[model samples]
Target: MLAQLRQQAILERVRRTGGVRVAELVRDLGVSDMTIRRDLEALADRGLVEKVHGGATIVGAGSTEEPGFTAKSARQQAEKEAIARHAARLVRPGSSVALSAGTTTWTFAHHLADVPELTVITNSLKVADVFHRAGRPDQTVVLVGGVRTPSDALVGPVAVAAIRSMNVDMLILGVHGMSVKAGFTTPNLLEAETDRELVGAAQRLVVLADHTKWGTIGISTIARLEQADVVVSDTGLSGEARAALSEHVGELVLADPGADEREAPAP
Candidate 1:
């Protein structure tokens, strides 16, 4: 497994067991003790884990964690950028797309400015601003009016009702967190409702999230895993995560900083 993916697995193991022994990881992952130590050390640097004498334990872990846009934007920058680029490839010119609110989708909005003759609808003020700043006459940008959350998402009955009124070619979404069981989710309940409306309005659902989001469950479920047409995430996702996502999602696209998006072999 890739080093980053290994680290993710280690972190998950630590979260589950509260701590993981180096010997167990070595046996389970079929890696050297030194390699496991290095993975633990790297996770420690990110404050995700705390290294003990022979293992590491989760640090300040909780499922209810929800960071604001600014806080989330600071994380997984390279991963998010690569995911955005790969997601842009899936967009055709002159098609309508809806974007749900979150930092990753906001980053993707920056990429969509160049796609010609597009109609963009979003519940995110930041996303609308990206297109508005471009001031493209050929592209139509619609900002749905509603209550804004700490994540800068406009969510409420107004947003959901407005989203139900239009159909789009694609819906590119960003979530607070996601998991095998919970699927794509948001921390805010109303945002989840609004996102569901957006999902129903699109023919294709493309979710853009980094590796860190894997196995993290939020407050509300937007859709089951099978509902997603595609999931674009970082290569740092563990083998187990990739397998689960492949089994559930229609397409699993892993973004790498240096290469084109990698896809699982189709059955």
Candidate 2:
């Protein structure tokens, strides 16, 4: 149909240019102003674009592939916080956990401050700074040394080597995308390689991702779906996604931003 073609063209333009104005859409798609508005609204509903003052921006736009920290931090604040709170419950006091880099992972670090007598290891300077500012002496923090990525993650051979030497109780991983085939993936190859090392060093792997990550494919995969012990995601996930993930992961915890209790298997 004409609407479908217009939608595809709009999406392609947004992906190529990072964003598009309503006026621009009207001009480019040769559609009316009302039609362009409807298309944008539909795209925003699907989590593909974010509506702003004059127009919409692709949700995750950049040559970097991953959204910048500030942009990502603002996109799904409530959902990430809810996911982090639920993930924090999985970590008990006096346990060692490895937290990966990303805005979602950073939110998890914030929720973790209340947890006492925990050792947290990470290659994220931002995460380290947050914990340092909180000053939880009862918690021991390990900052992995390596080359920093555009997203502020420490990666490369040095980081991978350091991560391989330590064993942790749990690994809370974050990624750019998650597909049945790709499992868990990142845009940066070095970061993906480092993630693999972290996965190998932990007894349990818990993935922290929002619903938008579903069905997307990134540059490199770190682990298979079956390799994850648990996956913590927002309730925005589709029914098909929930079923697909449940088949491979031991537990799929769905956190509703508006609710206190999360939906998960009754263990």
Candidate 3:
């Protein structure tokens, strides 16, 4: 496999199991031991993992580590796409919307890029680019300006100030993690602040996340589960997760990545 793809696979394994031994990666990937070490080193340099004597562990076991956009976008590809499709159905044409930064929200942006007379306000450059590429004349995109995070989100005071003045029909949020206690969270403090601003600007909040995000906690809490008008995730979510989210969120929607444009039956 190419180095990028190989690294992504290794990263996924580590994230899934919380760590991976070099021997295991070499045996599973069919790469040299030295190659495995190099990949581990690369991931470590990006703060995505912590290199140890014989293996690597996911960075920020405390949930403060922030992965770059490229690394995050490679994961849960099918799940993100599925969640995006289901979330898109909630939007109506010509309505103003706010999209928070994250891979899932970026995927959701593509599904809405061509909606007629829609106005989009966002802190994610990636989401803005999706609309730009669609070249829809009737769409207006407002790219909030601020310092960019590892996740390609514009945050800090400038972004927050811009969002506070506007009101949207709905806000599509993508979070780093979600739990019954922590609700929705992100590792970056500034990004969390900006996201809170986005939340306040919208009449309704819809969060898009894959099942892997469950139980993962970030350093900062963006909002509680009850703040969400809807939470959309994949069928991969655990039954416990569905029950908790269903109780707190206004609605819990599950998408089936394996099915063609179908939502998983609600719990």
Candidate 4:
């Protein structure tokens, strides 16, 4: 109970301040240095914070420092899984789907393991690996060639060129942040351009983002909210958020973390 409370407090402080120092945490939480270190380590393990030399920072804080894959994998486990499950349902067998690279998108790849007769085009080494290792023989995987980003994504001209050449049935995209004004934004410029091209290549675009993405703005805008065909999020979203999203997106699908069913707004 004490650990959970401390964890929650750390999360709140991180959200408020964008980052926190070990000494500051010890002073503010009134805990021992060892205890504070443990807290930070646990948070880092969960992908909530990036452990620095003396402190920790938020994963996507306006900086070039990228969180390690292990750390990212730990953060938002439940939410990503739920989003992936919801995304998998949108894909039909024998259809070509383009998946953008991100931890959340990687989760979507896992759920596609059983999807028979599907063709996937992606720029993620992790996504390709998932399909190569377990994907059925009937399924075809096309991995775009490009320089890999810190988040294990391939972007830039090579990736953009590949996307432009092919037409995909659906695109499952992930973003660093989304706002009514800012649209879909990311921290990396090259990634933003590649995402824009991906959106253009697909007949339908579905954005997979969690509630935490609300209100935050990144450096570059890929597309507006209205540009997305569908948006899938968790039930933890606020009423205002639901209404705000409904105004832009054609369909809003809210998935319950506890169940497989989804609450979708009427067409």
Candidate 5:
């Protein structure tokens, strides 16, 4: 594709999907990674898109504009995978855990599928399905009932009530955004309420977020930074954010995505 055509294609994808990843663009456009990065940079220079760590989000998306799960899954693919692997270490075998709805938590669920005698309670259909497909005879999954959101989160009074009656060793929570001012947040009001219930049900709160979530406030705040027992994110997070998290949260883990790639088995 020509420069103008390729950039226009990239811009359209971002506008339609709320974001577009550089890797996806490179593959689909049949171009080099550098070429796709240049296109994204050009688009960013025009204020057509906001450049994130691994992707570009649509310009002027508000706090209430929740992107769908598929859109979110495409951005920060490696970061989420790295965070998942690192966070999985927190889950002891034969323990109960709660996973809130988000792409990162969904990725984390896959890593936990084989843990013996594990019980998973979740408000995400996607997360539950991960365990269902695994069909681990020794594991149990409790999927809450509620209205489904664009991100596949089951929320409402039903989900909140179900979670309140349960207790888990850990809550692997994911947020739309996090900052000193907003703490952890989500675009959906019901999701925030349901997530708070999940937070209350757990003995420990381990937040899973990527670098791009910083400074991006959402419509509702889930919990304050001090409430988190641990926050697991990727190395792409900024130094200022790291300092803030370390001071407030019990432990701040920065997963190295490069290390994950290096450690992967050869195909």
Candidate 6:
């Protein structure tokens, strides 16, 4: 495809989906990675799209717009995979962890099942299902029941009530959008409350978000950046975002999905 045609296609995809990954475009267009990157850069320069590390998104997606699980799952595949791998390292065996509903948390649940003697308490039906499928006696998975959101999360009073009584070692939260000013947020009001409760119930907060989440702001704030113990993101996170998040969150680690799998946390 010609540069103009390819760029137009890129913009149209971003317009329809709110985001487009270069890898996906490369496969579909049968072009080089550098060519796709160049096309995204040109579009970004024209104020038509927002350029991110691995992809581009519809400009100004921060304003209370939220995509469902599948939409999110498709946006940043490699980044989520890398972040999940690193987040999994934080879990020591025999620890109780709380996972919030989001695509990244669902990915983390897959990795958590491999750990020995872990009890996972989560508001995500998808996360619970991972353990259910694994059928591991040593790993106990708690599925918090509540109102189901489009993102496949169980939120609201029922989830909050359950979270209030239990304390966990960590809360691995996936957010709709995050920023220095907005902190961690969700577009759904009830989900925000449940996420806050999950944050409060844990000894530590580790947010698992991809780079695209940086500038987006949801309707409700769950917690401030300083409240987090750690933030695990992919290397695709922009340098400026990395600097800002590192400053506020204290410990910001980047995950390279291409890296060989590191040893899991010691039991």
Each model's C-alpha lDDT? 0.85, 0.85, 0.90, 0.83, 0.91, 0.87
TM-score of candidate 4 against the unseen true structure: 0.77
Off by over 4 Å in 4: 1-60, 63-66, 260-267
Tens-place lDDT per residue, model 5, 152-172, is 999999998898899999999
Model 2's lDDT to the true fold? Answer: 0.85
Tens-digit per-residue lDDT, 57-109, candidate 6: 77765456765564566667778989998989999999999999988999988
lDDT of 1 by residue, 67-162 (tens): 555445646777888999889999999999999988789889999888899999999998988999988899999899899886789999999889
The TM-score measured for candidate 5 stands at: 0.83
| lDDT, candidate 2, 61-155, per-residue tens | 43237644544554566788889989989999999999999989999999888889999999998899889999988999999999988668999
TM-score against native, each model = 0.75, 0.76, 0.78, 0.77, 0.83, 0.76
Model 4 — which ten-residue stretch has the worst lDDT? 63-72
CA deviation > 4 Å runs, candidate 2:
1-64, 260-267
Residue 220 in candidate 1, Cα distance off native in Å? 0.4
Query: Who is ahead in TM-score, 3 or 5?
Result: 5
lDDT of 6 at 266: 53
* Residue 97 CA displacement from its true place in model 2, Å: 0.5
Each prediction's RMSD over C-alphas, in Å, is: 11.0, 8.4, 7.5, 8.5, 3.4, 5.8
